[model samples]
Target chain A: MRFGSIIKVALRALLRNTMRSILTALGIIIGVGAVIAMVSIGNGAKAQVEAQVASLGQNVITVFSGSMSSGGMRGGWGSAPTLTIEDAEAIEREVTGIVGVSPEVRDRNQVLANGLNWNTSVNGESPDYPDIRSWKIASGAMFSDQDVRSVAKVCVIGKTVADQLFANGDPVGQTLRIRNIPFKILGVLDSKGFNLFGQDQDDAVLVPYTSHMKRLSRRTNISSILIQAASADVIDKVQKDITEVLTQRRKGREPDFTVRNQVELAQTATATTQTMTLLLAAIASVSLLVGGIGIMNIMLVSVTERTREIGIRLAIGAHGSDVLMQFLIEATILSSLGGVIGILLGIGSSQLVSHLNGWPVLVSTASVVIAFVFSAAVGMFFGFYPARKAAQLDPIDALRYE
Target chain B: MPPVVKIEEIHKIYESGEVPVHAVRGVTLEIERGDFVALMGASGSGKSTLMNLLGCLDRPTRGRYLLDGIDVSQLDRNALADIRNQKLGFVFQGFNLLARTTALENVELPMLYGARKFTTKQIRERAMHCLDIVGLSQRFDHFPSQLSGGQQQRVAIARALVNEPQVLLADEPTGNLDTRTSAEVMGVFQKLNDEGITIVMVTHELDIAHFCKRNLILRDGVLVRDESVSNRSFAATELEKLSSAEAAAKLTGAKS
Candidate 1:
């Protein structure tokens, strides 16, 4: 007999129970669908994390002041004056792989401009702040070292503050009042969207460290220090070197600063999404296994129901192997058909999620192919025992079955 | 030509229960080409067992059997399947047509498993021809559920003949039909027999057995009588007589 006819025969038998066949394949449908949808969403989340990391800065590290203790009462991080501007200069001078360093102090204040008032964060930074944080000046110029030395009241406005303070007008040469201290806007920084913490990054103002300490907050303590490593490969090494230098400068007491690398932070963010994706895929695979079991159960029932028919075929001339192949082909067709439908369902669901949540979702061809092949293998694996049972039936006994 | 079926001292024992039951004991029979023979007995007389053995569906426990010059008593399952496909045809009492299938596809089923390669077109043509031979040319597309009992049996006969086997084995072919339909089915068999196709049938009805050329009676797991029919009955004449009787009965009803 030709192989084509065998397949034709198997297809005809399955068509006899169309509704049951579809219901049987539904298990695999949901399984593969869930698998594809979950994996795509997971991948989209990971990609989003990567983009956020890149936008934050490349090959960068931040050192924050440690928690403080006074009279056995501990305070939270940044509660005391632990890091200073001199520490930033010392790290820049001591570390070999350090490409840039900036001491930052932050305070929230109300700014008055064009007869409008808006509350925004004020940042005190040095000339290397732009290089360390990958900020670009959209217009005019940045504060020079001379401005920091003279504590000149010159500032750079971010995109959000610029839009609010000047609207369509140019704000580079305009003057704004911060805490009743008048400062000239030297430039506008380009827009960078949101950070990993979901905070708007382009909603602050920048000024020379000396001017922010003397004119605005009137404080000497720095909030944090930003460092730029020359390359991503050397970020951890640079962090270690800075930590070692800080500990030595503290005279063998506990270090008053904690150094963090961007690479480690990115990895932490990526690990979360990766875990979620793996967990979803694993759960979906369990349903797929259940679907396979469904196929097996239905196949066993079909074999028993068609016992006499099988006997008749065997008596007429069909070999045992022929009977086995017929059932096997039926199962494979069911699963592959289910797989195709599940793939379409998965893609549709992924699109729906992307639309509803404004999330990025990618359905790769490799994942589709893998899900399809895996379903096929599941069909074959589960269909074997029943087919063998049918093939091994004694014709006399089967024919004599009432 | 050599005998189509030669059986020598074949014994089939069933070890299913605690005590063994011998279904067929020392049954030896030979059926030549073009022979129309009927094996008859009451229930549990081993006639069905003998028929199963003749069809090569079961192996004999004691004796050797040859079918169409091939010793198939000890052959494996696949080898026996090949022999059954190439040389034997079977018709069951239930008509055994696959449900939800058209007559044409039902007739084409046997050829699907034939060792000889045949194109789909050829298989269709040959199936149509066989259905026409059984006088069902117009009902090719009707499913078994739509067909009457006699039409279903004719479709079964067409399926059996499509493979062009050397011998056709039928078990109670007319057990489910009315008298007129039984005669009609017997008429088909008689015509096929006249064309030199060997036939071996099993029937409990002596009247049904009378239509064949010879009768072999089994009793108590042994063949008790093997004799040629002294006065054979022709199914065509019987069918004519039945229709005439029906016509007379209808006339009487009209007069009343």
Candidate 2:
């Protein structure tokens, strides 16, 4: 018979058993929905990690002093004083791949602005600090190099500090007291949002490192160093150069410091996110397998129920392939319907979850296509046995069946 | 002249476990073009087996069977299906119309299976003509469930005649209908036979068997009698008289 007639027959038969068809399609619906939802959540988590790593800035390296032991005391909270302003200056002047360098000395203290006091970390650094860390001034202007040279009391406030210290007033060129010392706010840094580590980037204060050491603390030592490479391609070489310089400055005691490259951090985060995506997809694949099994079961039942109809068709001059194609088409229609419903549910559920949890959910076209194709394949793979069985049935025996 | 169907010493054995049950022992029969014949037998008398063999639905075990001059017993299953589609049409006791299809579509089914590339309008026109022949022109779009037993049988007859095959083989066509409905269906067969189309029917009712011009009676896998029914014409008056008599007998029996 014609292909259209066969499709019409299959569709009619499926509609005859509406409840059963819907129930069978539910398997595929759940399977595709799980796949999309899981992938979206996994991708969301990966994006969160990516944003965290990107917050550190590309082509940048962070150097921190290694922990130290007190004299004859194990497990002491002492840290080696290896990083210094001189080391930072040497890297900037001698390293071929160095773009900018900033030595930082940080301390936490209560700050008073217009009689509204708040406790926040104050980081003392040079004019290149914002450049090395990829922080931009949202308003006013960044502290100039002349301010660092002249031990100027100008400072830059983070968004959180700006919000807490000034409320509705513009903090630019306003005086704020840090550890009882009055300082003028030069600018407010842009918001960097929150990261995976839950650290709020908009809650610190920046000032000239030289002034903080000489005038505020009466010390010339630096705690950490931030270095920006000329480009991502030369990050490793620049890191090696900085390591050598720090080692030499520390008197060959293995530099007593650790260097962290943002490239490595970003790569690790990417690998972690991809692994998570695969793992979630794998878990979702189990549902597809179960859906396949459901299709197989339903097809087998359909074969049994339609044995007489099959016999009638065969008696009326239908070939075995026609019978096989009819059943196969029925299976395909069932699963395809399930796939469409599942896609809608998956997208809606992902959006709902994202809204409720305040997490980012991504639904890529690739995921949608993959889920739909997989569901159809599952239908075919599971529908084959029943179709073959129907094709192989003896016409006489099938007609004789009640 | 080419014979419509020829069976030569055909044997069919049914195996139930290790024992063999011979359904058709060694019987040969020939039906010519435009001949209206009936196979009469009780249950398990092998007449149904002979019909199946003639229809190319089952192969003879040790003999040759030719349908429209082709040796159908030697052909493969697919070849047999092709022959059935091209040369033979069938009606069954159960009126096996696809339950969900409309009457018109069911009538159009065999033509769809044929090799002719007919447009949708042509197919519908032909199907409507066939339905008109079977006196079901008004119920073209009704499903099988919506029709009565007699209407469903007429629809089945329409389906059988849609392809205009060389032979129409009906196995107990009126087995499920009442006596009046059965006579009405037999009238359709008689009219088609008068139009020079060959028909071979299997029926157990002697009254129904008298409708055909020839009869082949089977007894225990063998032909007991094959005779021409010269004075057994199926006149409408005779059928009405017989049906009234049957109804009167049933009424008297019920009263007793």
**DockQ score of the complex predicted as candidate 2:** 0.53
| Decoy 2 TM-score against native | 0.92
Fnat for the candidates in order? 0.73, 0.43
Q: What is the C-alpha local distance difference test score of each model? A: 0.89, 0.86
Best by lDDT: 1
Two-chain DockQ for each candidate model:
0.64, 0.53
In candidate 1, residue A158 scores what lDDT? Answer: 91
> Candidate 2 docking: what grade?
medium
Rate residue A318 of model 1 by lDDT. 88
Which whole-number lDDT from 0 to 100 does residue A264 have in model 1? 83
lDDT of 1 by residue, B195-223 (tens): 99999999988888999999999998899
